[model samples]
Target: MEPDDMLQTVDSVSFDRLVLEDSGRMAVEFMSYGCGYCRTIEPIVQRVASMIAAEETVLRVNIAADPELAKRYEITGTPTFVMFLNGSEVGRTEGPAPTQSAVIDAITRPFMS
Candidate 1:
């Protein structure tokens, strides 16, 4: 997939339908515009997105723009990666990941099978 198409940005109104209601596995990065880590890890996230299967989705939620999503996800920090399976959260990494493999291992490895 194209780099731009790798991570789709989502908001509270669309979050429920796009992430929560989706039947397959979905990974969401809860981030904020002002977060340096969010920006730093963006490339890694995109790379991870490219490595995932077509059935899985990668998304981003800007906490600064949509505080409700942050609150609902109990996001305490920016760049929190949450993975959902069948509309329910299965795993999460609540900080910046150093590498693409780390991001994948933390959030997607378990669900890959």
Candidate 2:
């Protein structure tokens, strides 16, 4: 399918199935539908998510839709980007990175080691 379609929101059973069970590097975006920053960075996030390795899964979680999940992640605002490795958070970015390069820089920084 298309690159944009690769980024999906994981919630409840889906989150457990895709991220917890798989046990690998994962990228998750926590966002809200009404947030301006979330809307602005979506395209850049999508493109970066697509270009990443197949073994790495890109996920999005809507805070409004899933408040419990949001609380669990400690997401206090919109457009929070988190990188998971072996089912644990290894990196995170709060607020809009604005550019693709910044997003990539945040997401891949942990893996550089």
Candidate 3:
């Protein structure tokens, strides 16, 4: 399926339903509204999300908006991407600095491997 890169801003409940409930999806990005890095790469994340969002759920969580959710997910940083496949945690990209292409490469790497 061809996924759109439009960034989705989700709340805690919506995030749970979208990411935890879903399986075999490409990726989800956990971010914070107050993080400068998150803002910097918002466009990149959106592009990556659009590219592979067809059958996957690409959600952006604002850690600051929902601290409990961030803590539940053990997200201690901003602009972190937690990728899953078949309801399993495959891998994650942390500390930002990833470009749009790089974000796509990271999540799709598991498929390639």
Candidate 4:
């Protein structure tokens, strides 16, 4: 799938169904639009989404708008990547510094390995 197609923009309202309720491995990026680090890693996240297996998915949560969700995840950074498998969190990487390898490992390592 295209990079954009593989990445889904989600919010607190839809987060449960899209991420926590999903039956496959997935990565959810908790971020904020005004966060420079979040913006810096957006492209790398998209690229990682496209590179991962088709059954896997990538979702993004705007912490600015979904503060509750961010709080639920205890996100203190702009680009926190959380990996879930079969509706439960399995791994996480809080920041990637916009590095492709870091993003890839953050999103893929838990399930891909």
Return the top candidate by lDDT. 1
State the lDDT of candidate 4 residue by residue for 1-113, as single tens digits: 33445577888888888888889888898888898888788787777788775867888888888899989988888789888998899888988767888888777888865
Query: All candidates' lDDT scores?
Result: 0.83, 0.79, 0.71, 0.82
TM-score for all models, in order of appearance: 0.89, 0.87, 0.79, 0.88
lDDT (10s digit) by residue, model 3, range 45-99? 7777666767666767777787887787788787778777776778787865657
Ranking by TM-score: 1, 4, 2, 3
Per-prediction tally of clashes:
0, 0, 5, 0
Using TM-score as the measure, the top candidate is 1
TM-score of 3: 0.79
What is the clash count of model 2?
Answer: 0
Pairwise TM-score winner, candidates 2 and 4: 4
Q: Where does model 2 exceed 4 Å of error?
A: 1-4
Between prediction 3 and prediction 4, the one with superior lDDT is 4
Predicted structure 4, TM vs. truth: 0.88
lDDT string, candidate 2, 34-63, tens digits? 999888988888888878857566788888
Candidate 4 off by > 4 Å: 1-6
Pairs that clash in candidate 1: none
Evaluated at residue 78, the lDDT of candidate 2 is 82
Model 1: per-residue lDDT, tens digit, 1-113?
Answer: 23466788999889989988899999898987688988788788878788885767889898999998899889999888898998989888888456877887876764865
